[model samples]
Target: MSLLKKYCLLGAALWIACAAPAFSEYTALSTLLAETASKLEWNPLLESGVLVKDTTQVVFTVNVPWVIVNGSRRINVDAVRRQHGALVFPESTAKEIRAVLEQTDIPPKVFRVAAIVIDPGHGGKDSGASYVHTINGKSIRVSEKDIVLNLAKKLHVTLKARYPDKVILLTRENDTYIALEDRPYIANTIPVKPDDAIVYISLHANASMSSAAKGFEVWYLTPNYRRDLVTTASVGKEYSEIVTIMNDMKEEEFTRESVLLAGEIASQLESAIGAVTENRKIKEGEWLVVRKAKMPAVLVEVGFVSNLEEATRLMDDAYLQKIEKAIYNGVSHFIEQFEQSKGFTE
Candidate 1:
């Protein structure tokens, strides 16, 4: 049987999980052809399938991965099938059709960097975690809040210098306290066009009773794509409704992008620090600052200030520069990759 027939049968037996893969992996062109006047015109020698959907045209080349939706080449293409009886296209190709049919809000072809929102965690009255050290019989104290704020400032300076025209906003420029809820608001409020991108980076210093907890880490929101965490039937009515509402508030696309941003930042940071805190690799974190942000967001723990050695290093301006530079480079890398994927140049 064709893949589409198999999936349809399977879906009937068991509800296809996760919103039914946005579109089935193997969608027979025959099915789409039968449903509409959309013609399946292909060249055997060229191994290409062209589906003309009104003004929008979807083109798929077999073996060679890539699809053209409405004349624009899309890289999200998987393998296009030309051998399975007629021709079957990958889900991405069908998704392109679904986007047009369903009127899905497709991202812009060109992505513009609108703003970079920086949140320096724990300020003003909140001293955060404290680390006390003695050097040459002299006592020194370092607070997580202070260290993070300093790093945030350096990062701001570096990013501003790099992208002078782009808006680089900080939740708190000084020692003044900003509530966790307010931080995301500040970022979400940034005026942006539909094609523009806004990234939220929340800086923080880690603290633990065990001084061994050292090294930098980045966090993104846990994936909730498969299950409806917001409306689980097992949970209480009031709580379930609240959770569902909150989960629904989070954009799945943004969460995926946030994960990518976190991974890039953590990889660069681990390289600079010369230590891979395996435990600190890109993982799920529900930090309010990151979770609530409407845009792609990540929370980075620069280092464990609780450790005497790390605390000492945090105090050093040179060390701070290195960490800040890594973060700056990571952000640059992310932007470059994002723009390239969207077919943006220069």
Candidate 2:
């Protein structure tokens, strides 16, 4: 018999033997497990009190609230435990599981993705922020523009290799200047099918005078763009007004989805660069690429080049590979979650 069926039978027998109040309806975590997981096993001796297999197996250990989801450690509000010969946890735990199920659930409809746009910030004459380090009596200069361009190229290559069928475009393929307003315009010009999805990622490296400021972060457009922005166009009055109205609507329309994607990327960044620093954060910011792009867009500060230690690490080829992989994983995760949430079957 299935776990849920057995539990129902047991509950019926117990109801006949004792007062109904003895058993609370809310404690049916096993029913939730049976409904959600393709397979579940309860073994007290096992390190995790309960084992669930959902595409991949995840273990929830007793007393330890964290659960391993597809090899990533995610915080769970409550720990898994065995009670009265049954695997159980707090009601909040069930709610958490429900949330995960909702995120991963397959949707009835799918939005076809047309293209993925990659923007590397500050190119050509704009060398962007730089940090100088002396090594063996030789001066080494690390420029944010160069590092971001390199990283964007690596990401482009990786994304192309992984999603061969998808259209992936880079704003500037080399060290050439592309106006901030024009970057998103390039993506906007791409022809796509109706309701097709598009994603924009702006690659950047932050700098600070404090030198102590270092860590990865992601930024999405906030909802209140019109109130926060100041119009600066004087010559192209008509064009400026049209752009402003479009940007304002885009920001308000995609805030929730952009924040969701940002959260996923930020969460994975913490795992990828945890050794470097655990101070990763996500915030709302207005940047041309993020604000002007009429799609789910985000700006990622891979690392701070201003900090001496981070500059050295960011300059490393192998570390750059890790950052690229982290970004790929985060983006892939968001795509999957978004597809499932939207009920996209394709």
Candidate 3:
């Protein structure tokens, strides 16, 4: 079979994400091929792909900002990348190639993560769990609201820098009041196009009556919660009758995604999971991940504040930085894979 024929056959079987509207800065490889009638010969394992258009040829590498034209000329543009493990291209670079092998235009379709919402639990009038400790005769107080807010800000800053195209938000930017319901509401209200996803992460420091409690825990919503996720606005008025079924499907998707996300965060925290607490595990901690948010949401109980030793760790800027790195990296890794597959779990 011809290269084009083979790719066409594999496109459906492989669930290729190489399609995006021309309006987006990034163009999927499939759209580019349709526009230019090009043949793609690329190996995903090698993280590189090539496009053939009559006498013209283009070579692209994942995360590379430049493309090799005809194996001689170097053209710089946005890097060729895997759209959720599927091949895609930057519009700027694809346009140059398109000009060479002009063909009919077709609208491109794509799925991407449009936004991320970070919520810091307990703010303003809510002091949350307050504890005082004396280290070497110096008394210090730990405030749950303050610790989480600071950590949230750090995570927010890092994520915002990494995803300039995404909407990064914090429910409480400062030590201000925000209702529990309002936080997830902020996440759900974020305007997004079809096939676009938004994830919610609520940060909090756990407290227990037993001062010995320590270590970190990540939580996800169980399947029991039924939320009104599908509506005429989401599935269109024509499909409104099946909204209930769609909502169930959405709940399953969100549940699976939440589990995966929580696992990632838990895995990343292993490095710092220490002697203070035994057997750090994933748990159903707070209801923040529950009925409130209409998306894949997780609540991270970042160690137990009730324990003086652990409280000290949460309060420590250096220790908090470690948590920040772990959480940030965890979220980033999940986002990369999620967006790569366009949030397809199965």
lDDT of each: 0.69, 0.68, 0.74
Using Cα atoms with residue i matched to residue i, what is each candidate's TM-score against the true structure? 0.65, 0.61, 0.66
Q: How accurate is candidate 2 locally (lDDT)?
A: 0.68
lDDT of 2 by residue, 205-302 (tens): 98988888899999998656643222325213322322343233334436666787788888888888868864468998888788788777899998
| Weakest lDDT window of 10 consecutive positions for candidate 3 | 100-109
lDDT of 1 at 208: 88
Model 2: CA > 4 A from native: 1-109, 226-253, 343-346
Candidate 3, residue 201: CA error in Å?
0.5
Tens digit per residue, CA lDDT, model 1, 1-346: 4222342454333222212332356666655554444644443334454565443446566665655554333545676664423456576766665565344365445676779998889999887878788744779988888888899999999999999988998899889887889899998778886557899999988898787888777888766532242344433342331333223323444666787889889888877875634337787867777767777889988888788788888888998888898899889998888766652211
Model 1 segments beyond 4 Å from truth?
1-30, 33-108, 225-250, 275-279, 343-346
RMSD of each: 11.8, 16.4, 14.0
Q: How close is candidate 1 to the true structure, as a TM-score?
A: 0.65
Candidate 1 vs 3: which has more lDDT:
3
RMSD of 3: 14.0
lDDT of 3 by residue, 62-97 (tens): 786766654445667787766566566677777877
Q: Relative to the unseen true structure, what is the C-alpha lDDT of residue 155 in candidate 3, on a scale of 0 to 100?
A: 95
